[model samples]
Target: MDQPITRRDFLNGIAIGATAAAASGPLLAASMPDPAARALPGASPLPPAAQDAFGYYPPLLTGLRGSHPGSFEDAHALRDSHTWPTATDTGQEYDLIIVGGGISGLAAAHFYRAQAKTESRILILDNHDDFGGHAKRNEFNLDGHLNILNGGTLEIDSPRPYGPIAANLLTTLGVDVPKLIKTTQNLEFYQSLGLQSGVFFDRETFGADKLSVGLERGPLKELLAQAPLSAAARAAIVQIQEGNIDYLPGLSSDEKKQRLSRMSYEAFLRDVVHVEPAVLNFYYARTMGEWGVGTDAVSALDCWGIGLPGFQGMNLAKGSIRRMGFTPAGYEDTGGSFRLHFPDGNATIARLLVRNLIPSAVPGSSAEDVVTARVNYAQLDRDAAPVRVRLNSIAIRARHIGDPKSADQVEVTYLRGGQAFTTRARGVVLAGYNMMIPYLCPELPAAQKDALHKLVKTPLVYTSVALRNRQAFDTLKVHRVYAPGSFHTYFHLNPHVHVGRYESPKSVNDPILVHMVRTPCKRGLPEHEQNRAGRAELLATSFETFERNIREQLGRTLAAGGFDPARDITAITVNRWPHGYAPEYNPLFDPDVPEAERPHVVGRARFGRIAIANSDSGGAAYTDTAIDQGHRAVVELLQG
Candidate 1:
């Protein structure tokens, strides 16, 4: 007899609840505009200039940046209301229903096919406008030539270390590791062109805009010499680099480890390392890029783990300190080698998978040709296809059809274009995110739900700016610049890559895309709280603000190199991921617990007719983790 809640009412309730929650705290009240609000309007016409010669307008370029409006609205409403409108039965059924269309989700479909050994019906439902979730491709056309760059999920680092399942998946997808290595960045070429690592200190942070290059000779000494710091601070840095630690006379290995884990890197730098405020400021942004938090929040052990120098007289291995240099050990040994990249980064992997799953969706036969193949979006969800990928469809509710003990089927209800549709599946894979799983499947155990919520995703921004030419970068004699105090922590000209028909910029006058990376983390906050704060800040940021920051930062830092922000800059695409990186073990906060006892491990346990698959579930952000988890989820679903 109760009236079903309308979608409008559900959305309104979410807005009202958010308003009430915001009213309770100033920080919450200051949160940015709903990302959905900034999405391109449904009726708006696409600008002709926005479309390239390839007839594609990259989503990041067209104002619809992050998660689309319909996607976020449905997910937010379902999470808030704890209910949904009655779903209209679509009379469609599948052997497997994967909730996300990211690397994990696509890999799930691949694994499911392999496990079943049959062309079973499978559906991949994604909320994004494009199929590849974070492994997105950003294509730019300059004077009729298309330049492709990755909007997210850039590289496959050392694929040799990947698990068996992941390695198998890559092999199955026609990804040749040896070929990828051969086609990756030509670091020797860059070095030959006077390209070297440099650091830029902003005027606001250092009293003067200064650029220091060639830090590999003596990173700490060179940095301190050029950095705006007191004589005492400079002396302290040099002393630390040279292994002078009279502060800690004698401490046992156990005692040192315990102390380092408990104490923050900032405290260790100021109190133990005896560095000044300016030194801490320089390190803040650098640390955030790696650990998603500043030195004040990250433990000293974690800082050391990522090769940040500070520890001395702790009997830390000599190789550890040497490895923390400007070039690092593995990188320098291999001439700065990065593995597995297409012209558009890892998006090629996703494209390859899509092509294999639904051969009609893309016109390509090999990895080389996939780079330039045109995707047939219209054919993604054909009824006749054994595998279907449905984009812009957000899965809201997933629940068991009957008793968990005997139920052989699960029902997934998703929202698309303001309409709710239901479909049945023999098995389900929750591959979107760890935290969202609890809300999507409320029938899960309370402990599992709590554990699922505990895994917080790190927020990040990977902004790709298309430049008119690389004159400024060439003039600066650097391909990469580390800006510790700028809005963007690091900016670099994407390394030249030649694969198939696509070739990165070869000449200085050629148009190029500069990749900028930023991780937003609040200092002095707990890890999870810092992630939450960062997410809030990411959602609040507008494209206009991002553009302004990019323009100002680039102009100020690259002025000496003959860079003009207005004339040289052609396009800007900000890939703002509120939930960017997967949850990794925090040495500072997370206890040294067994693998089976970890929250992600327990949270990912298979429930009735459903299994979890994602990088988060595996507790690592690597592409291999996603593939491995996908294989595990499909295997678990099949065995049960």
Candidate 2:
């Protein structure tokens, strides 16, 4: 069973809690470590803050001077530096050593701490001073008003959106989770193309045009009953919900097999509840934007797993909603989409996890106790097999370098700090992008990388802009805009946390921070081939190019919306994750059966140690997938 947060831990928890509460609104910020302070014996100064965090300029950088940026190589150097404590010195061995400090690594650590029976010593190495890779938070003072901005993974389907996870993670770590996932009254849908109108028969806006309807609160049954529909339509919808037919409208030849493998959602929509084509299109757009796949892309059997069913009448579990930081004016507004979040988005959870991993890191304890408990990275001598984890490191090259039988294990060399180093492990986890996987494991026959490369890739550029006035655009009902000509999507995010400008009683002139996200670059096709021996391969491009695309698109949006692009801007920052997200199912794979059971080697493990766990590994990039894989990997080690 998971241990409860002890009383002694409450002191430190309270400090972080107060900090989180203070930064509860939007503009939840995090302190950026100095880039110059990162220098080791021979290592060069690390990149500047802007390079590391997309040039997010909040006041956290004050007096924080460091230049050494942490990378995979740093872990190896820390291991050799004789700093901190380690199991190797105590003659102890661990089952695993997770390299990355992102969700994958943290989840693995959480699982191992809870389940593994092998007396495992979990060591997670991240070059950054803190954890929570992409899911991070930022806070700022826009014209004297405090606000928070989510740097990554802003919205999530947390078991409780505003309770334990959000509150504890943020307050405990001084992160503003509540501000990121801001609570809101309702969602407003806007037409992207002034599409043909439709109708809804039931709920608060009964017997109204779909384009003009706005749904208010009601139970699932009540809401469905409110929608105006013929008896035939209702029955057909019921059948679809009851798992009797396929309702997804569009399906390609290959998609038919995948959809029919289970119940089809299309059958229900056509034969049962009988939603009109226009209504279906609206539903399709919203669902696609949210799930990253068209409605037909999923089986009807899987539909209930997403948002609440429209027919079910807004079925919210009891006592799940909290009213903290919600404004009467925002809630009374006609159109808006809102939720609450912690300061660093998911990084809040990551920080909480790392605190637990450190030895004796209880609340109010001296920094020395925390330091003493830390498992030092240095103590890992090649001869010292007892060392469980070696962080701040990377395996530069791994290969079947010599004769097959005698040299069974792959030879791996890595750089640590400024020095080159070498080591060999029984197995490895290629838990990064698939693009990099082929380069490391070339022994696979048929150039598997090429096939993987053929799969369609989507590029996204996320931007966060904190404004000086929250009410400037309050008159606009729609928070999101879909610009078909320029990028995939754009939205004015309503942060989950309580931004002081939006919440403070004394503040009438607070600046609003509007975070706009879009896709600017072309990434769907495979890279052109350079050699004749093999087909053209796909090469990934830099993130800067992606950001440029977004800037260009934003300029168009300014022109279309009639906003002053130059004058309206107060403080603007851009964060680019070059490899944003991967799509599900490779273009070549059979979707009918599980990828693992199919003939191809997609999403499979080789031998035991060299396991791959990326969003692309499962061919599906999702929070749950990452968590499931992390647990699965831990289980694999435990079973071994």
Best by TM-score: 1
lDDT of 1: 0.71
In candidate 2, what residue range of length 10 has the lowest lDDT sum?
Answer: 8-17
Give each model's whole-structure lDDT: 0.71, 0.37
Model 2 TM-score on a 0 to 1 scale: 0.53
lDDT of 1 by residue, 407-495 (tens): 98999998766667899999999999889999888889999999899899988777778899989878878777777677777787876
Tell me each candidate's TM-score: 0.85, 0.53
How many angstroms is residue 321 displaced in model 2 relative to the true structure, after the best TM-score fit? Answer: 33
